[model samples]
Target: MEEKTYKIMSGSGIMNVIMGISAIALGAIAGVMLIYSGVKLLSNRQGITF
Candidate 1:
């Protein structure tokens, strides 16, 4: 009984860790893309005439 409980707990712990890592990685990628898009917009604005 105790062995089964330990296995289940370990599996859950590993899943939690994996989820945390993916979340952080995805968030970082999203931030970089946002910054890149903003820079692109500003760079293109200089070429526009009023």
Candidate 2:
């Protein structure tokens, strides 16, 4: 019984870690995209083509 409980607890912990990492990665990607868009807009306004 204890072993089964341990297994379940470990599984839950792993899932939480995975979820946290994914969330962080997604947030980083979103931030980069936002910055890129802003830069693009400014460049367009300046008539500088990339």
Candidate 3:
């Protein structure tokens, strides 16, 4: 029973690490996209028609 519990715990830990890394990567991608859009908007400020 203890061995099974240890295995489960280790698996969970690995999953947590993977999830954390993926979240950070996703956040970075979103940040880059937002920055790019902001820069584009600033450059085209006079072309906006709304």
Best by lDDT: 3
Q: Which candidate should be chosen as best, given TM-score against the real structure?
A: 3
| Tens digit of per-residue lDDT, candidate 2, span 1-50 | 99999999999999999999999999999999999999898878867657
Expressed as tens digits, the lDDT of each residue in 1-50 for candidate 1 is 99999999999999999999999999999999999999998989978788
RMSD of each: 1.8, 3.6, 0.9
Model 3 spans with C-alpha error above 4 angstroms: none
The backbone clash count of each candidate, in order, is: 0, 0, 0
Ranking by lDDT: 3, 1, 2
Per-residue lDDT of model 3, residues 2-50, tens digit only:
9999999999999999999999999999999999999999999999999
Task: Provide the TM-score for each candidate, comma-separated.
Answer: 0.88, 0.85, 0.92
The true-versus-predicted C-alpha distance at residue 7 of model 1, in Å, is 0.4
C-alpha lDDT score of every prediction, in listed order: 0.97, 0.96, 0.99
Assess the local accuracy of residue 26 in candidate 3 as a C-alpha lDDT between 0 and 100: 100
> Which regions of candidate 2 fall more than 4 Å away from where they truly are?
46-50
TM-score of model 1 (CA atoms) = 0.88
